[model samples]
Structures are given as structure tokens and as C-alpha cells.
Target: MDSSDREVRDVNNILFGGFTELFCLFLFLVSAFFPNSLLAGDLVEQWTGKHTRIAWVQDQGNGLDTYGRSPDLMLYGYDSQDGRGARPLLTQKSNFFKPLITP
Candidate 1:
């Protein structure tokens, strides 16, 4: 209500904002310094296979079309990098070393 009260509120807001900015900077620094090498460890274990599938499908919208870009430009997804042909790899029970997983 009063100028003094307003000033105090402003000070509190500034302090809170500064703290938030500093916290964000600290988080950015931490993430930048520390690599997430272990984040894909589980997936890496699954990918440790005796065979790697090669994908072959339609144009991934990387080419030029009559309009401008290909209408088939692949939409982003969990398997965006993989083509339609990669379904077999995902559907298969053991994409890894079959001998070890099966026997």
C-alpha cells in the first residue's frame, strides 16, 4: 500500500528472481560439465547385437518436391531416425546376440 511496503515487495521480487536465475545457471553449468554417458546404458546393452539392420524406405522428406519440401518429411518421434523397414528390428524378441539370449 505504502511506498515503503512497495519497495520491500520489489526487493523481495528482485531477490527471488536473482536466486532463480542463479539456480538456472548452476543447473546449466552442472549439465554442461557432467556428461550423461550412463543415460543410454540400458539401451546400449539391448543394442549390443551381432547384427545391425539397414533401413530402406521412402524419401524421408530430405529431397525437393514440386511444392517445396517433400510432403513425406518425417515427423519427429521416438523412432524418427528409423525408417519403416526397422519394424522387424523392434518387433523381434531378441535383436541382440540371439545365441546368448535364446540359449
Candidate 2:
């Protein structure tokens, strides 16, 4: 019916939607509020559990890790790139929807 009835229905809709939105926001922001929580750790737990290792690499500020036990026990992230890092070129000027350049 009337204008007052429509306004009350709209207010009910907003109140219900506001509570749902607040719940979703709480779920999204719980991690930021509590930095030490493990909410998504299970997503990677299986892979990390299978490949994780517990070893000590001796570091004495000499620019080298002394995992000198065996050659197969080499460390990672130390392979140099000759000072020029990875530079990827984007070959696609546009996607299926829109062009990347406006001009």
C-alpha cells in the first residue's frame, strides 16, 4: 500500500542486509585484527608438510651459508641473475573484453 508501508519495508530490507554485511566484514577483517591467527594455514599445510625440512645453515656474516655437509644439501634463493632480474614482457595489448591502452 501506502508510502509509510513502503518505507517500513525498505527499512527492514536495509536492516537485514546491514547485519549480513557486518558479518561478512567481520570474517574478512578478523585476520587484520588478529595478526597471529591461522585461518588459512590449512590451504598450504598439506604441501608444506610433505616438502618441509628442518636443517640448520650456519651463517657467520661471511656472505655464504655453510650447509657444507653435502652437495645435495644446497641452499635456495642464491642463484644470481647477473644483476638484471626477470623482466616479463606483456604481449597481449588487450583482453577479450577491453583494450589495455585508452588512446
The lDDT leader among the candidates is: 1
Task: Indicate which candidate wins on TM-score.
Answer: 1
Clashes of 2: 0
Candidate RMSDs in Å, in order, are 19.7, 23.3
Check candidate 2 and list the clashing pairs. Answer: none
Q: In lDDT terms, how accurate is model 2? A: 0.33
Tens-place lDDT digits, model 2, residues 1-103? 6797688668857866586456334433542443333432222234334322121222223434222322222222110112211112232222222112211
Alpha-carbon deviation at 76 in model 1, angstroms: 17
lDDT per residue for candidate 1 within 62-82, as digits (tens), equals 454322234443221112222
Q: How far is candidate 2 from the true structure (C-alpha RMSD, Å)?
A: 23.3
Off by over 4 Å in 2: 1-15, 35-103
TM-scores of the candidates are 0.23, 0.20
The weakest ten consecutive residues by lDDT in model 1 span: 94-103
